[model samples]
Target: MSANDPGHINDLSKDQEESLKNFWISIIDKITNKNKISLEDFYDSTYGNELFNLFASDNPDVVLLRRLRARKWNVNLALEQLINTLEWRFQWGVNQLVAKGESELSYQEILTGKTFYIGYDRFGRPINYISVKNHIKGQFPSETTEKLTVLSMEIGRKLLHCPVESVTLIFDMTEFSMKNMDYQHTYFLFNLLQNYYPESLGLALIVNAPWIFNRCWYIIKRWLDPVVENKVHFINNIDELTKFIDLSNIPKHLNGNKPDFNYIPPTEQDNIMLSAFQNDFSGNKKARENHQQASINYLRITYQWAQTNHNKDLLEQRKKAMEQLRDAYEQLIPYITTRTHYHRYGLIEEPIFYKTYQRIQQENQQESVHF
Candidate 1:
């Protein structure tokens, strides 16, 4: 790489850096309506209201950067895509669904264990296991399956940290047959990730894919963008998979050390947080108000950060604001959300369960950044 090439030395190219600044400036102008709109109103509108509150506390810089990179650093296209995503989240009730927790889907849908997250990859990316044989077309509502898929992706998102913004996917095709094929579901997953959550798939392992699946893959590859299709790998055996993920992280069935997936149903006790909130409405109301204030403050700082040119002091302020926003969100979690299997099984911790992978890495004292 040339020393003069900023892209090689920094996270963003000079042109991309400028586009990111302009992107934020444009959104702030549009959302604030020429500085007429209040910061609180701008926060609620763009973040999709209280329904999206639980999942809305995100680092503005990271969020905007992801969209910019997805659109190849084109500000207008990225802005359009961002708007479409927000509109879709509202129209499809995705914000509400995610905020309410994964309970929105039927018990049986989750029990099937067709799709769920497990351990993290060597790169600190969460591993999402998909048992292809476990899926039977027409057995579950298409919409329900879609919801589950989205929920799983959201779970993976929480586990992610800086420099590891993607998830590792393992599609166990041990039995592989035509009966397992669902073009509709496949297309939805492919398109959804490509368009809305672009550059979010680190790797995809199609394990033990039978010969017959090769024919289907030929057709499927045509539907993928070359960049995405290249990230996919056809694993012939355990050895092939071990190359990408540690054996300790892979399941025993796949010739790895980890235990196989087993779903533990959620119980009434899992709603302990919700029950607490209901029992003490007044106290919970105060907590919610504090959270709302923190949110508004974060947005205010973010807006200011966006307008000013980059500087060490401003960046520190933005970081502190993000920490405060996260702290408020953590404190309000138990009063607002329901627990899931991830919580019950101890795979996740309540009241601020994001970034499990990062936590694990810190505990193990692993600081290397895997590529």
Candidate 2:
């Protein structure tokens, strides 16, 4: 490739870089505003209040709603604060779990508090006291380095309490590889907990490696049979994880009681709203078509309301009309791309195309001046 070719150089001109940055900032700002407004409107609705109460409790929803309102007004700063809060809460939970002597295998050992050493073998399997101690020294400090560690553990504890004879713990192997012990420590603890404390509760922890999931479908099916399928708890985050364990009624579950809430199904309206949100401004032509059809259907329903209630206030009807217009605009923006059309037709691939054309025009003017 020629040295002057745009692709050959990694750096952009100062003005070009500034233009790109500004474009990205504008897009982020627009998305942030839309996200905040949608979330706020949802929260203010009756169904939103009910959902919030079910998840966060009655008292905390007030605080959460206030934060959410602030986020609607100042989205970027609120998101940063939210991240910090979650991180702090997660660390606090881990500290509490460790302090409760829940980390140790034996209750008697915890009570005695002897300076016992543990060791591991070549494969990092727990071998003896001395080796385990060495492994802990090497890996324990930053072992569970996830934002949702406490919630993940709580889900594990709940799944262990299930009435079924055995349970399978499935995790993303790609994520597991980032950790120090390569998930060996977690596997060992799961097996140990199953064997020593709750012998009846058979535990099988499976790491679903990237390619393995696609190739080993039969193996996964064999493991998830009638015996273990009901007890199995698949977890990606703490919020979705409440399906496996009930945090509110923890003591009852520990004392051999079954969990109260089995699962929460997504409401039909919520599903529709989510589907609308996903396909709203998707770059794909097919997605835009689907969203347009959905918007048409919604408009038809609202139009019927307008017709049936002749006495209904004019302002209410106008408000609904405005919402429909906004939805129409959302559906249309994806299709109208003048700049992208030029690029697709091989007109230009770089911002320098404009600059080069402008420079050529300037040189011709200088030659004309000489003439």
What are the clash counts of all predictions, listed in order?
Answer: 0, 12
Question: Which residue runs does candidate 2 get wrong by more than 4 Å?
Answer: 1-168, 174-184, 199-208, 211-371
- lDDT (C-alpha, whole model) for all candidates: 0.72, 0.32
Q: What is the lDDT of residue 104 in candidate 1?
A: 88
Error of 1 at 361 (Å): 34
Off by over 4 Å in 1: 1-10, 34-36, 46-57, 351-371
lDDT of 2 by residue, 231-333 (tens): 4433344344333333342212122132321212334543443343334343345433544444344333433443342435543654555455445433332
TM-score to native of every candidate shown: 0.85, 0.18
Worst 10 residues of 1 by lDDT: 1-10
**How displaced is residue 227 in candidate 2, in Å?**
10
lDDT string for model 1 (240-322, tens) is 78888999999887889988888877676455435544565555577677777777776667667667777777778777877
Where does candidate 1 clash, by residue pair? none
